[model samples]
Target chain A: MAFDYDKYLRPGKLPHIWCPGCGHGIAMKGLIRAIDACGLEKNNTAIVSGIGCASRLPGYVDFNTLHTAHGRAAAFATGVKMAKPEMNVIVVGGDGDGTAIGGNHFIHACRRNIDMTYVIFNNSIYGMTGGQFSPCTPTGAKASTTVYGNPDPTFDISKLAIGAGATFVARTTAFHATQIDKLIAEGIKHKGMAVIEVLDDCPTTYGRRNKFRSVVDMMKRLKDIAVPVAAASKMTAEQLEGKVLTGVLYKEEKPEYTQQYAKVIAKAQGA
Target chain B: MSSPRVEVIERYCKGCSICVEFCPTKVLEMDAFLVKVAKPEACIACMQCELRCPDFAIKVFKD
Candidate 1:
């Protein structure tokens, strides 16, 4: 059977705003497949996103969604989880929104170990904002703001999540379309904060500026630079150079924030 | 089950050619700016075109 994506998508939302060959669509499809695999109730799931190209994803999906202010998806998602405590909260945003503008909120949410999933589409540049160099942009990458190439170092988003206390951290590229959904589904099933960083492509903004001739070139770049975690472990450091590790990098059991808070409430009520 | 039917929803397709280019089998091709099924008999149901398609234009139906 052909996967009927129309079931999860809303009416008249087809022809999304993303440009041709933008990897966001592939990532979104992965997300839809993951959501379907999880069998989450449509009404019980809340998809939250901050302002960016990737942020627009929630609008197309049939779910309780919130398109919040710039870099505030994590903060808003945290509130949603604290209030309902039962609803599944998922946050999606681009690298700039997650790591630059919303960096503090993102880290804090991870630190709190909230029972939510955050999927960061790290395309390396702020595509919606016209090719601004984001925190995940590789050094010497060209962006509209960085005509001479970016001088700043990049953030390893999965590592950042792990350091900030997220219980699950995974990474995959758009080229690994199937892996994206598997990781996301695992994150949704996890009890604590789970972050999945998907390395995507921005053909119109990031690609054109960075000398990637076409979308295929960008996709090829993602494919070439990715090394699976199992294979990466056996590769020498020199062989692993310039390649990012894909698959679940870190996972652990932790006391989820919601459960911890519930205990506090019970104790306060003398139960 | 027979070889899967590969369909391209033309309206939703942005003519990116990612699916046509990435199909493991030579089952797809470009028709002007849009994509079409060039060699349906060659399709192996790998679903790579459908999965990697940024446009959600491709679908493979297995019997």
Candidate 2:
């Protein structure tokens, strides 16, 4: 069947709030395609988002959406999924929202292995809050808050998620549209906690401050810096310097939080 | 070579008119807050309208 994106898009909201040349739209399209590919019922889906440019996504899609306070999407989504185990819960937020202020929740969510998908739109900067420094902002990158350049190293979200016990973890860039769609689709279908970090561009704040000539230049940088895991495995650590790995970094199945909790409750009741 | 055609789903259009003002090619026109493809043929497939639309109401499909 031909893909019909309009069916999932909310009408009367035609123009989005993202700036021109921003990568959020690219990520959103990939997500929509993934949902379509998974054949998920619209009514069965619930998207939760925290404050950020990326968090604004749930408001645009025609689905059960919860726009929560800054850096709290995971906590809110946890409650939602636990309350309705049958609903397909997905969390959408940016680097600052998911990894900075919400860092504690992010790790707990991964460790809990909840049945949900978390899509981190990592544009590096806090795009929605006027381009502040975020936990994922690259070292030496400039932001509104980091006028002289960021001094701290950025968190490798994929590695962090895997180490924290996420059952599925992947990384992709908006430049690689097709691959992103596939990754998001797989994350949604995974029975346990899944995290997909999408490297995106924030042309207005990130690009302008970082000396990126244009949006295309920023995308090119992502493409040039990203390395496939298979290819990286063949290379030495020295050879992998300054390169980020894209594709499925890790996947392992374990009991999900909600199901395990239910079993515990059932056993206690019986006893 | 033909350019991609942009379709605006009016129902989803919040009528912010961001597309109408942002279209570098002047491809969009506003009518009572709703945007119409005034110059569909002129679209360069830059996807500015599609990307910037907060509502995701506009789609640009390559012909």
Candidate 3:
């Protein structure tokens, strides 16, 4: 059976505003499939996003979407979760939006272990804002701002999330379509905060500057560098240097922040 | 028929050819503007085209 992409998307938003070969579409589809697989009610699900190309995703999806300020998707999502704990809130943003500008909020959200899912569309560079070098841009990669090369190292988003106390963390590229969907579903089902880093492609800005022959070439590159987490376990550190470990990298059951806060309130009120 | 039906939303497809490249069974081909089902019988219902399409322009269904 074919999954109805149109049903979840807003009418007339078809032929999305993304470039011809952008990988954000694949990530969006994975998210929609996850939401469907989780049996989440559209009315009760809230999709929040910060400013960026990936942030534009909320506008296309049919749900209670909040296109919040730049780099503040997690902050807005945090408020939403507290105000309506029953609603499922998911925050979406790009590498620059999430890690660069919203870095503090992101780590705090993970540290709190709030019941929400954060999907970072890490395309290496900031695609929407004219392809500037972002925190996740690999060292020596070229961007509009880094014409010579990006001097700094890239941040491992999944590892950073785990370090910040995210209970569930996973990484997958747009090339691994099925894995993206499966990991997203599992992340949403997890009781505590979950972070799913999607290494998406931006052919227009990032690819052009980075010298990827085409979007297809970039996709092949992503597929080539990805090693399943299980297989990666046996490989030596040297062998896994540049490879991405895709799958649920870290997950542990813990007391969710909102639920714990509610318990505190209940005790104070004696209710 | 047990064969699959491949539909390409012409308005959405920008002729990126990602779908064509990923379709393992060679069931799809690029037209002047968009993708089309060239060999529906060989589709195998794999849905690689639908999943790999960056534009969400293609859909494969067993019909």
Candidate 4:
């Protein structure tokens, strides 16, 4: 079935701001497909995002979208979910917005295990800010901030989400469209907090600094390095050194925060 | 299933060739200014072309 993207997108927001070869659009479409598959009513869904290239997604998506401050998307989305516990709240952000400036909120949201979905477009650089090295930028990759090479270590977002108590977590690249759509839908369906880290491409900024010959080359590299979680389990640590692991990394049943909060309210009311 | 029918909306195509390069069946090709269905019979209806097009220009329909 073909997805009616026009129905989910803002009518006048055609021709987005992304560069010609950017993979953010692919991730956006994957998100739309996921939302459609989950059967969530557009009016009842809230999409929150911070400041950055990937964060601009909410501006184009037709939902109860909130273009929040630089690093406060998760915090804002938390409030949105708390107020309307039945609404589906999803936070969209880039690596810089989600992990660098918003790192604290990101961790707390995961630890809280709130009923929301967080999708991180891990393009590894501050694309909108002239290609500065971001928290998810590879250690040796070059960026505007690191002309020679990035010396700082990168954050494994999926692993971080797992360690921080996210009820559901998954990772997929922009090149894996089907997998991206399926995983995102699964994340939306999960009861508690779900963090899906999508490895997207910033061809104009990250690609230029990192010496990717073309968008196709960068996408091919992403495809080559990604290994499914099931296949990765059998491989030794040395063999899996540089491979990107995809599929659902972890999932567990836990009490959602809002439900617990209701309990507190009940106790206070002497119910 | 029969061969998939590929349609390229020229106005939306940016001539990126992402679809041509990523097509697993090698069914698409890049013309001078836009994409063309060089071998429609080879299309597998994977929808990779439609999903990966940054410009939302191409679409594939399976018969």
Comparing 1 and 4 on DockQ, the stronger one: 1
Clashes counted in candidate 1 amount to 0
Per-residue CA lDDT of model 4 for A1-271, tens digit only, reads 2666888998777678888778888999999999999999988999999999989999998999999999999999999999999999999999999999999999999999999999999999999989999989999999999999999988999989999999999999998988888999999999999999999888888998788998899898889989999999899999998998999999999999999999999999999
Off by over 4 Å in 2: B1-63
Q: Compute DockQ for each candidate against the true complex.
A: 0.75, 0.14, 0.76, 0.56
Residue A85 local lDDT, model 1: 98
lDDT of 3 by residue, A1-271 (tens): 4688788989998888899878898999999999999999999999999999999999999999999899999999999999999999999999999999999999999999999999999998888889899999999999999899999988989989999999999999999998888999999999999999999898999888878898889999999999999999899999998899988899899999999999999999999
**After superposition, candidate 3 runs with Cα above 4 Å error:** none
Q: What are the root-mean-square deviations of the candidates from the true structure over C-alphas?
A: 1.1, 5.2, 1.2, 1.7
TM-score of chain B taken alone, candidate 3: 0.87
- Please give the distance, in angstroms, between residue A168's alpha carbon in candidate 1 and its true position after superposition: 0.2
Compose the digit string of candidate 1's lDDT tens values, residues B36-57.
8999999989888988998778
Query: In model 3, what are the clashing residue pairs, if there are any?
Result: none
Model 3 chain A scores worst on lDDT over the 10 consecutive residues at A1-10
Answer with 1 or 2, whichever has the higher DockQ. Answer: 1
Which pairs clash in the backbone of model 1?
none
Model 1 chain A poorest 10 in a row by lDDT: A1-10
Listed per model in order, the count of residue pairs whose N, CA or C atoms clash below 3 Å is 0, 15, 0, 0
Tens digit of per-residue lDDT, candidate 1, span A106-167? 99999999999999999998898788889998999899999998999889999899999999
